[model samples]
Target chain A: MKNHVQWESSLFELIRRTSVDLPCDIEQGLRRACKTEKKSSRARWILEALLENVQKARDNDAPLCQDTGSLIFYFQVPVGFDTNALASATRLAVARATRLGYLRQNTIDSVSGSACATNVAYGAPTFYFEQCARGTVDVRLLMKGGGCENVGKQYSLPAESLGAGRDLEGVRRCVLDAVVSAQGNGCAPGILGVCIGGDRATGYECSKSQFLRKLDDKSPVKILARLEDRLLKESKVLEIGPMGLGGNTALLGLKIGSMSRVPASFFVTVSYMCWAFRRRGAVLTVRGGFKKWLY
Target chain B: MALLKPRRLEYPFTPEQVGSLRAGQFVLVSGLVYTARDRIHKYFFDGGKSPVDLKNAALYHCGPVVIRKDSDWVVRAAGPTTSIREEPYLPRIIKDHGVRVIIGKGSMGKVTEGACKAGGCVYLHAVGGAAQVLAEKVVSVKGLYFGEEFGLAEAMWVLELKDFPAIVAIDSKGHNLLRRVKSASLRMGRKLMKSSDPFIP
Candidate 1:
């Protein structure tokens, strides 16, 4: 609360960790996928390359992917906390992280196509702040690359092409369609974060938020949790494998969340995440000091 | 039904060598590779000239993490980006620059395959997010172009590589490995969706 410089430093550390290190669950998913493929197979080779890259990035303290992706932050704090201060601190941390090579200069002008060297332009680092009763601060970050973002798809229900209706069957079909179309383009052995029953904009936002969850963490809703597992198991049948060369492991995880929607709209939003899957969180103490890292 | 051994490639390679390579083959590429992404491709599509010659060279679709160290630019993470996004501009770039091999993640479309076949160029699929591993293969950052104008990610970075890993996803013979994978998956996907198994909500 008193030392502004220290707070910024703590945020910088969070940003750096999120960029350079691959979380254990994701790394384990890759390792497990590597074992499933045949010896010396293309899928195995690709998995090995990814695992090897993960280690090298951590050991060298380098950004895992050159993209360093879009910096999306979720801040949950107590009602009385100063939100504006935290936002400014985060923006400073992002720019410093870029300069120190933890993050690449990735933001660009939509009008001119020029790069934002500092990655601090308006709407560059997206922040979502909400008040929580926990009386603490939790900042979560997801570095989603452009490649996978380009592959994210949204489907409207009652589609003749898929025979998808306004039900779970429809959601499943839409997800399968998304993965099938993405193939290896979105980077297979990927993860799918889905949102059902939300409006067009909120649908994608909710789906992306699912990436903040651990690979093994099921949704609180029992049906959604079961769907998550079923979707993952079915993805292997697609046989897209890692980077789409074809293998046993098609997807690592699938998470689905839902929001209340108007009767007229039944949108299924699918947010595709590449195997890189860089997501990290930090819990701050009551006095605005770093408490612990939340994977 | 692919070979275990990785075929070694040196950049500025010939048409015959590129033609001989088939889809689904693993390759360890070495030598001069040029990095370019959406902006550079758009530049070329708009008839902008390349400062460095791209004829018969390895064109990597990457926006690498490079920084200055004692006056020399160093590549920290130089993994491939998704290639499909560049499809609109690739055919023209291949025609204009005579680009020998295209390196990136994911599969491209019909026109890219046709252009590769006609131009005798091949598409190489590098591990999508293996930037640090790929950067390790980059022995040196030789030169840069359009750094100021296009920004770091969009600029053309000339890299000297050694034993960089990739696979031949689209060969010069009009064969596309990624496309084949997608089509087969599509059949399975159709069957799965049509199955009787239902998720009881």
Candidate 2:
């Protein structure tokens, strides 16, 4: 069995990099959004400030945002790998990261509404473990903040109000409604990960997992790919702009996927991410050393 | 029209001073501000007594990132939390605490706007997700209340700020930028949806 300490160290580096660095694709998306706005617009300036903050955080090795958010680790391991040992290592890494100030102490007990200083609340640092046939392990990390999480919405389709059914067009309308409601609330010029079908909980789960995809990647399904592009454009046309100040760019990216659902339920779930899209990945060597960083 | 510069606001200000501020204008706040989140607002609205006097103070809807240094706490990153979460409690907090300004990210609701007008307060919007930039303006951590019980995010942190930057989103006159944007965006959304021009093709 691989030493748990090595896995813990790998997780620490992953958390640190995820906190400090804004991925190139997201940065590029912001740049493209910036160009579409006028020179004197608040949207433009907000993007500029965001870009500068990204650089400053990298230089200073500080937390990107005050709310480091819930640490979600997605792991793909070989069939024979020690799953329990890996889970323990991840928890230890999260605790170490919090103590080292790479992550903020953010977990809370929903019942008592009290802080769990260690950030290892019962359901927090959400883990998704997938066993693969390959020998190596792959880990992807996404830090989802509460502000954006609050704006996430799930819609039951075949609604008369939006003229939406269970089709791709229905998904289009549902996603737009979410964007409009969000306004500047979820921190505008955000990224959206949408799941077109599934039950309520799984829809949200599947939607959040889409954040692991690269910002520029299009859905493999031709129709879903087109919908992604359409949503991105419609989001820009809303004039909610950045911080709802009004401008040409309102959304940075849109990612959509579908899941088989029961006939009665046609759930479309959307997960909103603020401009600070903190996600990163790493491929680990057999000994648990970082083989390479994935953006 | 020229861009509105950030008006300087210090603590112990009058309602008229706050009333004079308009929505869409920027402001630089200096002096003492207290940090409070959803829990603390609930505490105040639930008839909890104030541990410290809050008259004419600026209340920031922020859950700051702080670390223990030697014996005291040092603020590493401090940014505004979503203000809408505290909507139900804001009006009462403004009235009961004599709060001159409510600072946070995003915008509050009609209740908050009405409260700002009636109670003589303004809502300020700090740039969301810009924690490191905002932390630079926090000169010192003056003190903390309920830190042990509420934890770092929910605690009432007394902070000394120097030229803290924010935009006036909801003014005392009931001029709410957020409200205006909502209506405008709703109209725009309808118009764009009508085109059916296949934005992607």
Candidate 3:
């Protein structure tokens, strides 16, 4: 109800920015990966092409990828914030963005198999709301492509086939298996977010949530950090470079998170993120105006 | 090995043009092509036919982001989608449509590869997620089919392209560059699991 117009405007900008602009951290990560690839290699060519595409998309104010994938919004708001008003504003912004060509007509009706060009269906633009101690409001947008989403895998523990147990070794094997299976299909040189243990649904949720962390940030859990570093190194050996062209890089980085699970269950979920990695965040005032952007 | 400069191929793409190429070769493709993804493929495979012609034609696995301004349609992002999803329909599509060139991201399965070899067709792997850059090459929207039923991503959109960049992943000689990547990665994965290092946790 408060500053409704401002909310829609700021949210639309955020949606547009998330679609067009490649975050600086992910861009830097790509640059670092590009340098590691030998010049004139197929991998090198692919990476160069990706970087050029990034620049072109940013300069032209175009959507980074045609997929424009799932529009996932995560919000941190003050207590007593108008959740309904903000949700309605976000929906309007998404619809306007779709019409303006910032978003593709991506949402499909499951039952009718119809395209919702407006991109506002029952749960098309998935939103997550959490109240924080601070008074500020913040929303993050992740436009994940379908290609990468399709390759995300969830594994159960004590598998004899992969020689994986209910330990970190099992998790490691599962992640490596996922990377290999995905190959170039999911768009290689992907950033992986791994969740160690949880229920089937929550396992995936925790894994995907790990992507919210910056590419350069380190996991606070020491053991998980070690696993992340280890996987990042092993991935390089796989030679699944940019677009799975067989190069010096296989992964940008790996972030691993663990959850307490019931004694009977152990689930490992791997969320594969392509090089596009289109995500952007904005910090807003209570009055619903943009204060600054967050990577 | 060094990457080769792209081989330039124009419209009216033919089996002879596909025969000249090998796996791992990059090429700049130009000409008119039909865009189809999962739904359109299913429709075609299930005996559905449209006005679009496919004799010696190119098939692009893409779901482009398009916007209509005035009477003209504008393509915003036109990048490749993952190709393997259409594996079941690919062989038949090629055989039935007389499709000479298949363009998409990633590689196809063994069945699709065999179809390419038998059909004298080539699979060109486009840059995945490079939508805007790829769309820049789309000079015009020639036509659209099944927009109402199949929706945007699944509808068949005819596109005229100029110098669209892609690499040959499968060729008429049954050569596949992606297979090498696959085997090597599988080998490396086996080695990682067999390593002496203890689990991090």
- Best model number under DockQ: 1
| lDDT by residue for model 3 (A142-234), tens | 888889999999998987889999888888889989989989787877889899898998898888888899999889988888889888988
Error of 3 at A43 (Å): 0.5
Candidate 1: stretches off by over 4 Å: none
Q: Runs in model 3 with CA error above 4 Å?
A: none
Q: What is the C-alpha RMSD of each candidate to the true structure, in Å?
A: 1.4, 1.7, 1.3
**Docking quality level of the chain pair in candidate 2:** medium
lDDT of 2 by residue, B90-142 (tens): 88888988888899988578899899888888999888888887888899999
Cα shift from native, residue A144, model 3 (Å) = 1.0
By TM-score rank, best first, the candidates go 3, 1, 2
Off by over 4 Å in 2: B196-201
DockQ of each: 0.78, 0.58, 0.77
- Candidate 1, B28-66: lDDT as tens digits: 899999998888899999999989888899888999888
Alpha carbon deviation, residue B110, candidate 2 (Å): 1.0
